[model samples]
Target: MNKNNTNSDSSVKTVKRNKTRESLPPKKYQVLEQDWSINQDGVNIYGRLYLPQNLPGKKKAVILSHGLAGNYRDVTKYAQYLAGQGYVAYAFDYPGGAKNGCSTGVGQLNMSIFTEEQNLKTVLNAVRNRSDVDRYQVSLLGESQGGAVSAMLASKYPKEVKSLILLYPAFSITDYAQVAFKSINRVPDTLNLFGFTVGKNYFAKLFNYDLLKSATKYNGPVLIMHGTDDIIVPETYSEKANKKFKHSKLYIFKHAGHDFKGKYVTRANRLITDFLKKN
Candidate 1:
């Protein structure tokens, strides 16, 4: 990438390396980063589209979703990697998803799983409608809260999603909401959570949501990765999901936490690419 051209749509072309790690293969094409934004419910959802130069015909695409309060930049690396592997990649910021997000409208006060779900659907439809994308081969990859959103969408539109990949998904959110307030009557109108001010709507749908049940509705292949030491969202949630899905595999990283780190990230990426290729 050219340091001076980072912000331009036609600016960055991923640099290729002569040597590659045994675990990670060399990129197939020079990836180009472009600014791609879409309008949803009268507001703009800012995002980036990574296209592999000179790919013939319609290409398979992947939609990368960030975790709660995270922006598209947080998952930019994944988009670059997938684009390098010959797949078109997209990463976007959800409305009101982050304090400093590029997207407009909605905020922490009213952002909920349901709202995020709608945001993802809008992205999926836009990506599918692209002339260069193979609508039938689009996949969804998400982290934490975004993972839950992806799973729910895959369940609702199984035929549209080729495969699903979840990284330390927040499937326990529904249960956490119940335990936090004990019941709906005890729910407060507003509260500070993880440095964000949230309202009752944040937990409204989650109160009666069944993540695993909704997730298992999608009969497509699913790859679930979780860390054994994750305290924020215990591994048990993923374990349960793995068992419930008809065709799913779960990989547990020894020392990884809520988000992967060090070699864990590399291993997870390899697994992700492999799964996408086979599925």
Candidate 2:
């Protein structure tokens, strides 16, 4: 019986082991910062580009816009984080977008949301021309007032923008104008609001502009993050925006204010990475 069992075991067909597949190591990325001067309609737009070094082939790109009275510095960390994740990240100072920034001043009278939109367009065009950028995978990320501009731009150029990320977007500019002016026909040429001198052109340009309607034009995926405790821009604005977007996700961080810091910023960064990867 032992001999018979041995014969049966020897007769059993031997299966060859599949070739051991070796997993490739994660790509090592080194963030290389480059200063860029983009010309938009003859206006000089200054920006910083965070390029992921050692990565081969064209990479996805993200353009980060700062909030009102903010410069590229406001979004520098975001740009660096995205670059570390194998993306080409750019953060630009809008022409006249901030009171004190690297870019040329547009003056308080000339500074408005419309002007900022133009600046964004210039940056977008410049980024698309880059040989290392995958134009088809370009994304826009904006904070506060910049968020409003990004939404408008995405809607205007839906085909160019693959995704949108808005951080506590201030969609209440028109509302604020209404409250300040009371009567549409009685707006002053220049007025001080929230410590910034705004011109009538700001109100005139946005008087009939419907943010919700414009946002719906872009059907691409959108990630809107707003803090429940935000006071500058109410969380409700983000909720309303989520409903307007065709493919949208909203995250409300408890106890987080309009500006994220510490753990809140870290959480936001992780969410951004996940969202970009999944989309």
Candidate 3:
């Protein structure tokens, strides 16, 4: 049996073996903390919480979901900055998927986005049910495909989601599949095309789904941020959703690529801070 096919260690949730991120130094954020969990759904995930050193009386909270093949640290820096400005900001890594299954080769980025039911469930549980947390004021922020999951969640529970901030969200799964097909044509037909899967596309058994189509059903305040130079997800995806949403806010960072420009980091943080404050 493939080592990757074996079940996880059952004990730890999102067990990340490497602790040395020498390439990226921890940012100047106020406080960094993590709480790993094995949810009832049997998924291990990382609950990375960024708190303000000095607690604010009572403030809104934001839950962040990172991009494909990403962990909590992917977007925890943004959460830290938000916490610095007085918000309960949180993010997490998918259980088993990050450290164990991912290493074993049973992991797929595309599937992780849709399979994030456990991930989102854990996040909401921590915020709404936490003794010191506020339920009604919780918002969500997602990047890349995480944006797609967040959009679906916001639509699924419109009343619960006060607002959504999508950073270069994956608008269409088929778009990527189409591109992959074109690339795969290079290989001979004999090769096992679906031999192994590494993204949400392989799982979820997806044909096609548009993030904009999902967000249109959501009536909450929406903030869509994108970069003109983003070749990965493209800027049009964000623009399309902005056009459909009744209360959508769009921020285009010029000359920015797949990752957002550092210059607009503060601006993006401010926008989310203000949106969550809305009644």
Among these predictions, the greatest lDDT belongs to: 1
Candidate 3 local lDDT, 1-279, one digit each (tens): 543322222111111223353232233336646564435544445466777666645657788887665667778657887776667788776542343222221234434455664467566766776654677777889887678778878888877776888888877654665555544334233222223336433433343455456555677788877777788787877766776666677777666677664455655665566666663
Q: How close is candidate 3 to the true structure, as a TM-score?
A: 0.74
Candidate 2, residue 270: how far the Cα is off, in Å:
0.5
Model 3 regions more than 4 Å off: 1-38, 56-58, 96-110, 178-204, 208-210
lDDT of 2 by residue, 138-218 (tens): 999999999999998998999999899888898877777767676557888887766677777767766676765665457
Best by TM-score: 1
Model 1 C-alpha lDDT per residue in residues 1-279, reported as the tens digit of each score: 643312121111111222445357878899999999999677688899999999889999999999887889878778898999999999999887765789876766788888888889999999999999999999999999899999999999999999999999988888888888877678899877766777888887776777767766677888888888898899888877776676788888776788776566777788889999898
Off by over 4 Å in 2: 1-28
Instruction: Identify the superior model by TM-score, candidate 1 or candidate 2.
Output: 1
Global lDDT for candidate 2? 0.79
RMSD of 1: 10.7
lDDT of each: 0.83, 0.79, 0.63
